[model samples]
Target: MVPKRKNSLGGGGAIPASAIVLGGGEGRRMGGNKLFLAVDGLLLLHCVLDRICPWFREVLLAVGPKDASSLSLLLEGRSWASPVRVVVDRAPGKGPLAGLVAGLREMDSPWAFLMGCDMPWIQEPLVRRMWALREREEGVLCWEREGYLEPLHAFYSRSCLPFAEEALARKDHKLKSFYPQVPVQVVPEEAFADLPGHRRSFEGINTPLQLERFRESR
Candidate 1:
């Protein structure tokens, strides 16, 4: 495990870093809350939390209003490395942007790593590399694949709250809508070439077929 770094701002504080997992999707394609779907004897949401919790001071799960009850039940007896908090989306059905906003508001960290619950194959080394790359920057740091921005799997600074909120206010829930208003560093594919499974690191299981394939592969 990488040693936790102290916050560089001085004052004898630990690094104010946290992670947010967005599990509030309607799951229209999956026919149900995909996060609860089992994989390797554990729920998909638990798998994601277990992988990312160790890397941050706090990890928050943003779920839809209806999904909260079941999720709380699933977490009852589970143990996690970092403190885990469950946050209900303030604006349900507003898409990932709303979930992001909800998670950011609850986070005490100045920066947070954002991801979808369906993306169970997140690479820790790649995540750590992105953390290192954002050390001196004050914006979102994420990877770009085949001309598409992976906003859900990225690093966001709390400083971007205004832009995010503004986009939400305008009902423009697209995650990228607020990107133009903030400083963004798009990590290219080659940047993660040396990391194993880089190609699948950003993959998400959004449908039953994908989940079935993932299960079979595992």
Candidate 2:
């Protein structure tokens, strides 16, 4: 039971920000929709949602058209996520960046922590810690020395919507395509060395092998 959209959200514990969850992936690597896949009896999507719902006032889930109706049914009315909304990707198959564009437009917060449904290992405390680094940057992202960036596990401000739109218009769907236009704080991996399982925090379970390995590691 999806909650009705409210003009106001209940207060007390949730952070003022929102968590934007991107679950529009085709999941070809996982053989099908991976959101339904489970780890320890909990659906992967549920795992990710449960972890962040307590930390944010609202959460926006971006999904392709196919999952729209089903997801509405899946919510089962989690009151903690009272103001949650399921935003369908305007460009259905254009990938995560498309999902991102849709989310940004509907978001009600200045800061939205972006993440993927497949990435259930995200750590909220570490992410909250990164909030300070977002001082003047348009967003904050995790970057590796190997030239890899974990955009799915970063934070983006409402201000980035236009730049993201500009990139989408040019068919440049990569998240970094709009990077040069915005100031993004690129935090190095070393900064996360102190958090236990920090490396796994950005690990996405997009493939069966990765899921298997993750389960084995636990």
Candidate 3:
């Protein structure tokens, strides 16, 4: 049987979800830059955008101004093919919470699928599954094996904007800290496995070694 879908966004045809590829991380563990890392012959950022572009109405990338020019050069004329927009973070080096706030505030759609740019292994099918299951809950986030939320790769509603903004204002950057204040659903590993591809896609790429692993796997 098909799993129940919540919110049912994007209308009957396209999912109302707009994607926010959070590419503002410092990538310190990867020795400086990571979004530029090559994975399976594709830039990690492009691999992420390519995966989610088909599932959402618009794709907005939240990147840093320092790397904005290079990122723009990567997309150039390709903007004609998709509704891709590159937005820079106002408060840099703050963390993923800041990026999420920027994404939600800049969103023109009802829901936003937020993911880190370093995750080249994340499959589109898993993203679609999370979107389909998004409920009245503020977020449909990942339940990592270590029993923590994978805040980056998740589905957050537009309604969570206010709370998220407040969290940032209070310097409460931890995504888990706001969970008690709003509704949230954890997409367990079993449920995530229903979608095709490796179940460990939520595993983030932090070092060059991890990037090499992704290359080897491909």
Candidate 4:
């Protein structure tokens, strides 16, 4: 659960940082919600959180209205090594664009890490490595292969809020829409080689078949 909000007079006291887990997708390709899929004995969402908790002071699961009730129960009455929160999308059916707007609005931190729930292989070392490499630029995403930028696993500065809002207003829901408007730094896959098991961090679970393949490979 998101730690209780805090208010302090000292402006430099501390910055409230957090991670927003995007679990609001319709999962049309997967035929159902992929966040609940089992991976290595735990739900996919949990696996992602397990990796994220070490890096973020707080975690929020941004789910669609339809999934909030059930997801809330799962988040509640459970103890985690780190704090977590479940927030619902204010505007449903608008895809991740809406979810992101809602998440950025609710986030307490100046910098929030946006993550897709399907990437179960994200490692803590990779997160730490990326943060160290991040620039003041508005966006920083993972780059793999020749020209693949994993926008979902990225860092966003609240400074880009207006750009994101403008994109949503134009009905341009894709995450990359904000790239041109904001300075983005793409970290190549090679940069993460020092981090053990880094190659698997970009593996996203979009379909049941992919999950099976991941299981077998594991």
lDDT digits (tens) for residues 31-147 of candidate 2 = 887767877776777767767888787899998888989888877765555377899998887878898899889988887878888877777656755553444635544445346
Ranking by lDDT: 1, 2, 4, 3
Cα lDDT of all candidates, in order?
A: 0.81, 0.75, 0.72, 0.72
Candidate number with greatest TM-score: 1
Query: Model 2 has how many clashing residue pairs?
Result: 0
What TM-score should be assigned to candidate 1? Answer: 0.88
Model 3 TM-score is 0.83
How do the residues 46-125 of candidate 1 rate in per-residue lDDT, one tens digit apiece? 87887777778898899888888888888998888888888999889899999899988999898988989898888777
User: What digit string (tens of lDDT, one per residue) describes model 4 on residues 136-168?
Assistant: 645544454456787777777777778888998
Q: Which residue pairs in model 4 clash with each other?
A: 1-84, 2-84, 2-85
| lDDT of residue 48 for candidate 1 | 81
Encode model 3's per-residue lDDT on 1-218: one tens digit a residue.
Answer: 23465533323444677778888877788876676877666777776676667667887878777877888888876643248888887777778777777888888887887878777777656666666665564544444545667777777888787888888788888866577777787756566554556466677788777888878876
Each prediction's TM-score versus the true structure: 0.88, 0.84, 0.83, 0.82
* Comparison by lDDT, 2 against 3, better one: 2
Q: How well does model 4 score by local distance difference test?
A: 0.72
Highest lDDT against the true fold, candidate:
1
Give the residue spans of candidate 4 off by over 4 A: 1-16, 39-41, 137-145, 213-218
Q: Which lDDT value does model 3 have at 82?
A: 48
The TM-score that candidate 2 achieves is 0.84
Clashes per candidate, residues 3 or more apart or on different chains? 0, 0, 2, 3
Q: Which 10 residues in a row give candidate 4 its minimum summed lDDT?
A: 1-10
